[model samples]
Target: MCKLYQFVPIFCISLSVVCAKECSIVVLEDSNEFIKIADCSRRGLSQVPQTLPRDITVLNLRRNNFQIISNFSFKRYRFLQKVTLSENKLQKIEDQAFFGLSRLNNLNMSDNTLDLLTVYTPEMFLPIENLTVLDIQRNIQEHNNDVYRYPDVAFGVFKKIVYLALDLAPIPELGQGFQNLQNLKSLIFDRCFLKFLRGDTFENFTSNLEELRLTRCLHYFLHVDDNALSPFPKIAKINFEGSCMHLKQALSMLSSYSGKTLDIINLRGLNCPRFNSDEYPFVLTVTKDMMRYLKTVCVETLDLSDNGIVDFEENSLLSFDRPECIKHLYFKGNRFAFTKGRQIDELNTFFNKSIALKTFDYSFIPVRYWLEENAVHHNEQNYHSSNNIIYLPRSLEKLILSNLLCNDIRRHFMNRRGSNLTYLDVSYSYSNNVVIFESNASFTTETLVLDGHFHAALYQIEIVNFIHVKTLLWRSANLLYAMYPLDNMFYKRFITWFRKLKKLEHLDMSSNLLWILPDDLFLELDRLSELRLSKNLFQSVPTQIIFCSTIKTLDLRNNLLSTVDYATRVWADLMSTNHGFSLYIEGNAFECKCDNLNFIKWIQETKVDLDSRSYKCTLLNGTVITVLEAYETMHDLFSNCRNSIWLTVSSTLLGTSIIGVVLLIIYSKRWNIAVFFYRKFRKMVEKNMVKVTLMMFSFHMAGTAYLGLHNV
Candidate 1:
């Protein structure tokens, strides 16, 4: 009995110690980046560790209310990098705010009320000499003029720093040589260049950085000299993804610069080919020497998307050298062709020998070459080499052949040679009038793109498991397959085939014959985000469309919508406020009655983007107006109708008097009543008044016939 009692007491103590809640501790071992702490709350604990572990990067102190950080407050951890102080109430950072730790990098101070930063000193960053990456996004009061005087002393602070992201930085003053950041690898000046960043403003790291990503800049094409990019010995990547370029002279100079090491260049949104022919020279861009440099090894990953280049230069593809270096080309939105047979032989020879190439994406290129001979020669080779797209060769990995393009159909008819092709997208083109899979099908594509248009009467496109395709692409196709005279089994087969796709990420079924979708069809989505079901036969909004929570973009434009009200509520139920999505609802005729009241209300409040150009007020009565101007027009027209009604009421009273006068004047026999009544005063004058009124009314009615008022 004594031993049992002693053992029970000891067991109770051990259990209590193991389950006891300890004090909240968030320690930063060596100032690394990224830290995750769950249930970081203990009763009334106010302060916690400001930094985290050495290897753990990108800390999220989100939703935590912190007031301030003293000097060396986060200097304990040297390896700590990328700290996120977002969604917090941080007021200020004392002098030497992030000094001490040597390797500390990437500080995210977004969404805070911080207004100032003390004049920087050496001690603040002495601990971390190789510090790089800093982001103070969404901070309201980052502009502290007292510290933005382009102090030469601050220039040497980041001598070895790289990857500087100061988008929407609150610094008021900006200029070249503001700081001598000699070792920057990437510089992101998003929107911050709107007011700052002159021609020479990027001199600090222009000579050193390899990647320069500028988005939302008012002047995307800021000008600079050869010395601007020449400073960086190993420059490669460049991205101008958003907005148009600012200067054309500088861009042309850079593209043709001989002393440049730029390998990965993205001229997206630059619209290079559309460069006002009058102001910019397009013909002389890729000179013989420039083409040789491109082929040899100067640059890679060429992007001409959104350039609107429609002119076909026979030597356009031949300008770049052999496949030993250049690969992965993108010529989307251009009108290059082979009309002149001057360089067709060279292009074919280059395509066959270039073995170091990979991906090739060509959206729209006109056909001017010897159609029959060009297609036959290339088709015979089954061009699948890495560098050239002239033939479908066995070495090809990813090939995108737009069906609408003017290419030989026989080349892909059998496509038995496309065994090595992992990704193949064939949207029909003008020249590819006929396309069908040959029976001796041994090659299996991992990705297959179906024609997005009704050029051919392919009613159903569901592949069997015989092909190794994991993704099925539908490009902007709108064919009422159920009513299609060609294929009645398309709808049924498509539904069954879609369920079998286990690794499909992108599915485009926009502009089809879908009236409403069954709920079960959406359950097949694993992580689908982009859906294009616009311009369908749907009369009412489909609620099942919202079941896919992973969907980020839902395009229902050019659809059969009568009102915006129901769609608004449907969005509210489907989309969480914090997780908003983009909804495309253009070209929809909203019934301009009580039904539209809800739609208008929702459009004015929701954060989603609607196609503003297509928002025309469509009414049941054959009248149309812009949605923005609908209410005003209705008020004006209703007022005019009201005025017309009042005029009719007054005219009726006048007509009665005129009719009586006409009876007295025309015959004069009915004047006895008027004469008798007026005899007591002035009967003669009253008799003439009736005669005059009768004549005027008769003239008015006779004129009405000519005025086109049929009833009048």
Candidate 2:
């Protein structure tokens, strides 16, 4: 007692104490009566603490080497609320480790050595109903449910927990998994559930569950038979990020008609195939009456991704309601090449029917494929556009159509009309002079994302008399727009028309051909806050932009950037006179030689947003090498010889030497250095290639074995 009192120094003084290579301890003597155990990091203690003080509240034993925890090891921690034991060596928890924690709430056990929970009893966590968050991740141990046993009663307590994570390993079994959990909200099961889940496993989720996740689960071949998910009727949301590539039998097995579920269904890793044809069929199938019955289905967000199905029936679109009432549709990462006129007509039908649809995303498809296929859906025989998708839905708000080819640009040639919707993301697209805008239409749109492509001349955009748009995103506008007299009068008309948009808040023109913003562009709508102008052709930032007091989050990645002194000159003008702003200069190829070196050094030393990320440079001599991969010094980014003497001398010397050497031992045959090197490299590469050149070897072997068996 005397030693404890002496060590309980109630002062803010530095106290350093090193522990064993596998063990460390920190005693925080706060102004209060309890001892604050803090930072027992990087030690190798394999067991749970046996001598924890009763009054300790904040215990941080992160980055250690702990393994097992017997009964009553932490039963005395009744008031322990915050405990972080991340990156440890602990595996199994034997029931009573969390016995009587009344006020315990946040437990972070990330980066541990546990794979699965084998033995847990009801007495383990009886007093823990007030927990709000729990995290246990990164287990290096093996997980096999045949050997591990479930807890006696898992859901008996901790019902009020909000955020829960078993990220490292999977939950082995559902035996008494969620028995009394009445108010569990956010649930996460990452890389767990190695085997198929036994139905009736979640029989305890009788109450309304908010968010449910199954990320990286091994046994994604789970089905809902009889009483499988009976208790979880009020589950509003579910995210099934299965580790498999495809779901063959899953749709038939998991599709429930209970009518109690609602909100969202995120079929993530939808690209991963799960079942084989022999094991589970019904993939890419238009069978029986399931397609017909899908008409009555309703989901907020439908994610059908990574399914490499190139051809689908046109009637599939008709399955959805028209003037469409769905919220967000994600079709990215799928090989959805265009179909024929019949499919195009069906899409028109679906769009006309479902009017409430808000967002539609079809980004990341190949430019050629999208253009060749969907952009130009010909009438089976002809390869030209007909009455293919002539109208855009009125309910459309946010649309992402990216990576389109120039042919598709021609097809969408501003000749078509669309809704005056809110948001549009048309980046990674090829825009040409094909699209024609209707006169006097007064294009009324908000938040247009024109990043990642060459925005052709503003025919419709520039000629429009009164265009009302808000939040213009012109990032990655590398190419030239079509000819437009958008100098003084054009800016006046455009700004006047744009100033009518009272809701304008953000203006992102990053990575564009913006040498300078049209003179007084910022004075029009002062409500703008988020401005992004990174990765552009700006030799000098206009000093007038500093007056934009409302602007924050400025991006300036990758451009013909000059000195850091010039950047500071801009920031200094802003900070010294006007106000505060964040600056980004990440990928700018600045001349970092003698004079420019000072700018680079100053940028590093200042509070500017260099972001600590590496910048890649394309040098002349080291042009073949990557800046990130090469261990070269930073001076190479700006160092270049002023005189052509080095180039001339080196070239002349090499030429003379080559000529003399050619006279001495030049090969009369066609065998040169290039030929020799190419042959050697090709031979070595071919030699070192994988031996299994014959793909589908298993199928070939199976066929051979079958033939042999038949002959016998």
Candidate 3:
């Protein structure tokens, strides 16, 4: 009991010592670069590591146990340019803690226990004159339940600050003392509690701020007074995503920034006010009056994703007086009402005037209700309208319709010329609806993405429909069968379909559960340079790829390959010799064995470009090693294999040589050998005959003596 009591203290002391050692800082060395970095993250360190180099330019001390930043704590790091002390237990930063960091341009002190009273002192940030980016978000924790307002002069000294993130609670107003921050270009106030934006809220910014983010600040609505953003004439970008504001408030916000060309306005999830919610469910249509102020504000990109917007008032897009000014629009995660065949006319007329609009994303729009409504309407009308075509803006180049219901996209785009659209994405569309492409209704988009499962009725997506497609992405389509291997008919169809894309340059069929491809799959794709078959069930390098001379990059990552065979490597080497070829085989199951010695050697010597990292090969005894380590010590590991191969070749040559020499002796002395055998045979025959004759003579002499005796 006494020994156990004594050992407790020793063990505790040893544990503390080990923990101290684990908290040691690490300095990254860059031999070819001048920037030195010190990383002390997640170490439970109570204080900064003083052993770091004085010339370190970047320091990361996030997620530590630092309670306070003492005065002049970083005075030694004079060359420091960026420092992050986020996610720490910091309660106070003593004045002059960053006294000598004159070159510090960025500082992050977010996610700490800092209070406004202790952090807002005049001397707290007086030394960082060159600092351009400062993030102290989520640090103004409540003290005694009293509302704390930011002081006017708190950040007045940071005249050169370009970006500031103040994602704290209960910030009632941006104080008037920010007039000195004339160079402040970006400001973020995400998750703040105070809602009202008065006209003078940003009047002190002196018109230099270019970007403002008030994302998710007001959970319900954010009221903006008229001319609230009139002070910053150069403000180009604003994000109010998830700020459930009324349409009038949004118009007021845009009105304040009139005559200024805003680059992006992201109002995703606006949750516009619904009129007569009990009578008309899901009727949050964007009306022309709600967008009247947008006519004065020339915004280039507007993202209204997930806003519960069902339909747009006719000529709503024209509310932007100069419709050509708006270029990109995102309407993802909305449920638009497409009831009848002519319901697409609303969309056609809505964007008919936006001639310069280039990109449009309408992904994730559910159409289950629309399908039911259309069915009911069709039953009442007793007729079907096959001419339900959608007319997109002629100037639009890129369109994304992913995760929506399939509505015969080729038929919708039948009127669009091949050269008008550049990219089209119909991936993840509903599988129940069948899409058929008429011979004249093919899309000539440069890029086409067709991922996810299509119904069995979609046996032929028919690559002829995408004859001009240069890049095709067909990932996760389940090209192979589930319970059985790929059928010959399906394989032949794939071959025939892909051969039609004569202009295909890049093809990605990743995550397709594919084991092999037909030999003629890419036969006619003479321009194909890159092929991606990643995340598949390929056990070996596809034999069909060796014949593709135009292929320069082949990505076969995350496959079931145990080892690449010699023939594939030879073909890859040949391709590398003729032209540069990069074969990415990362994330494959590789095995290291004597039989794979040549493959290991090829990895080190092949001219084909292979991934340097993520090539872990398992050995015979279940030991795992990286490709680099295997390359470095492969000679020692497989020396016996090399010796065995040499032994086999030498033994084969020796045996063959001895057999040839014996055959040559028999062939050169054929006549002599035959004559010697003949002479020996004759001698033996003569000896036998002489013995027989002697026996006959003895018998005759006996018979003659007996006859003479009888006569006497």
Candidate 4:
């Protein structure tokens, strides 16, 4: 048996050696059996590895310093599907570099120094007949003016390429190379220095192309030929973002997509000099002619944001033949003067055109100067026009009108057409009465924001109308002092209306100059989970906060609180019930003395989440430290103060006791002491007489003795 097993081992050793030699390179198995991946990227390799696995389907060689891709480099890996050689110093790729890789679908050579397609020979892409995605973006040097030429036969070889990214790779002209790519669906030419788009520039790709991006092209002007994209029946997206397109070119581009079902059209930051008028010198106005082109395209979402649009010409939107096709319109960060009556009327008319619009965002549209000068005129005109009502589209569900300077916003809500509106943001607006729902009107809106200074009347109206709102933000509104001293009447009025907001869950009243909160101010908000009251004048945690059993986030930052007793109690109560709540009590002026020693200790040992790193304390010597750091060094100081206080009290008590004992002894022995002193005094006088006689005799003797001595 031993002899037979030893003879079988010889045959197995020879087979292992043969298999190792055939598949010597590193390989990573993919989930799919047909695809094997290998990564030799950034290995400082000068040439392709020689013995790569034959079944490798994807190879990544990025960030290497290889100079050339030699012929038959991937001949063994005939099943390769993708190869990425980006960010390399590759200068040349041989004509048959990808020889026998007929199954390859993707080839990326971006960010390299290669000029593989400059000559446009058929052999450039001869090996990869099935390539679908070819990315050669950013391959040439900055000073190189040699554009990539596409010969007619080269396109036939790369006909299967559906996605092509040629960013920063200039092309001399739209030759028959593009016409031969019948299967191409996406074409990107970002930063390609394309100064013009002729009428038939994309005529060959009109039937199969779906996405076209020309971002940041044509620094001076983009001259789009008429009906340039008219044949693109299936095109879904066209992006010209950051392109300085002339007004005529823009109109012609839009005209090409007339009556086509486009999903998105992003013309952000489009520079149109023709629409700039003297009245609005720097900004472009959406004129009737522009609207005429926009209405022709059947688009779902149109992003015209950051386009320097100041205002819409009167009845400009009315010119739209089919405005219902657009669902969302974004005009944020534009400078619009919608303060005059005519301007407001024009805006209202514009909304009336887009009856199917679901969202309209006009936030940050500055109207301060216009409102300051024409507010009264707008009011008078509104009073006479259609009963002071402004209409909105019936299909609008979300509206944002933030940072507008209109003083009276009641007209915006009067006779509002949409009952399905769910989100409304009017923050940073100077409005008097913003919400004016009819008495019989009911709304389905869940979020409402009025986070700006407003009139008292508007606050009152908002409190009543937004009773069903779940998220309400009225921050920095000076609501705390709208009625001086926050009198009982004001509290009653506020509570009366506030208690009706039973659905409120998120409330932000931060940056309001509130010194104290009423005990029952938030009792009725049973569903509140987040309360933001930061940047106020509060010196202590409001005891009424304990009633918020459902609160998970309490923000009391940047206040004047000096102690944490109430805060500790609040944290304890919340934690004892297992109701997790994050406390933001940083930026408070906490004292760092023995008086607050317990508070400092509590903060250090608190189990609840707190922003304690910024919880600073002011010491007696004016030294500020974080609460935890102060706690580490303050225990001895507190103990020393306690000992000193005890020592002073004990000394005072001992002195008092000694004085009381002396007084008691004197009072109890008062008669006895007086009789004893009287007898003693008599004895003392008798003794004094006797002593005085003896002393006189002694003095006489001494004088006689002295006289005798002197006579002698």
For each candidate, the alpha-carbon lDDT, in order, equals: 0.54, 0.55, 0.73, 0.71
- Displacement of residue 28 (Cα, Å) in model 4 is 23
Quote model 3's TM-score: 0.71
lDDT of 4 by residue, 1-712 (tens): 0111110111222321322111113444444455556666766555666566567788788787777888887888888889989888888877888789888999888887766355335786787878999887776455244554545467567877899887533334456556778888898876556555776566655387899888876444555676777667678988888776643356557776676678888877666454354543336777877676777677878877667776677766434556778788877767764544776666677677787889878777654433565555554643554444557676888888777654543454543534567888878865432445555556767888877764543545544565788998888888776534556345556667677888989989899898887658787899998889999998988777776788888889999999867555655556545877688888889888877777877777767777664478888889887777777777655667788779999999999999999999999999999999999999999999999999999999999999999999
Worst 10 residues of 3 by lDDT: 1-10
* Per-residue lDDT over 501-587 for candidate 3, one digit per residue giving the tens place of the 0 to 100 score: 899999998998888776567678899999999999999988888778888899999999988888889888988888888999999
lDDT per residue (tens digit) for residues 127-174 in model 2: 565778877644535654463444426545676777766642333444
Per-residue lDDT for 192 in model 4? 59
Ranking by TM-score: 3, 2, 4, 1
- RMSD to true structure for each model, in Å: 21.0, 26.8, 11.2, 15.2
Candidate 1 residue-wise lDDT, 1-712, digit = tens = 0111110111212222232233222433444533422222221212334322334333445556556656766555555555566667777666666665555666666666765234334554555556676554445443432424343354356676776665433234444543577677787655443333343445445465678776554332333343444444566786665434422332443543454545676665554334345544443333343243344444656665545554434454455543544466676655544332344455555556655456666656554333564545554465442222244334556666573465533222223344456676667555542323345645466677766664343432424442355556665565555334434665555555556665565667776677766446767776666677776767666776666767667777788877655644666446645366777777776766544654655666656655563377666576776666655455653455467667988899899889978976867765776677678568678888999999999999889777877656
* TM-score: the better of candidates 2 and 3: 3
lDDT of 1 at 538: 70
User: Where does model 4 exceed 4 Å of error?
Assistant: 1-251, 271-281, 310-315, 333-355, 367-383, 406-412, 416-418, 431-435, 456-463, 488-493, 566-579, 590-607, 610-620, 627-712
Candidate with the greatest lDDT versus the true structure: 3
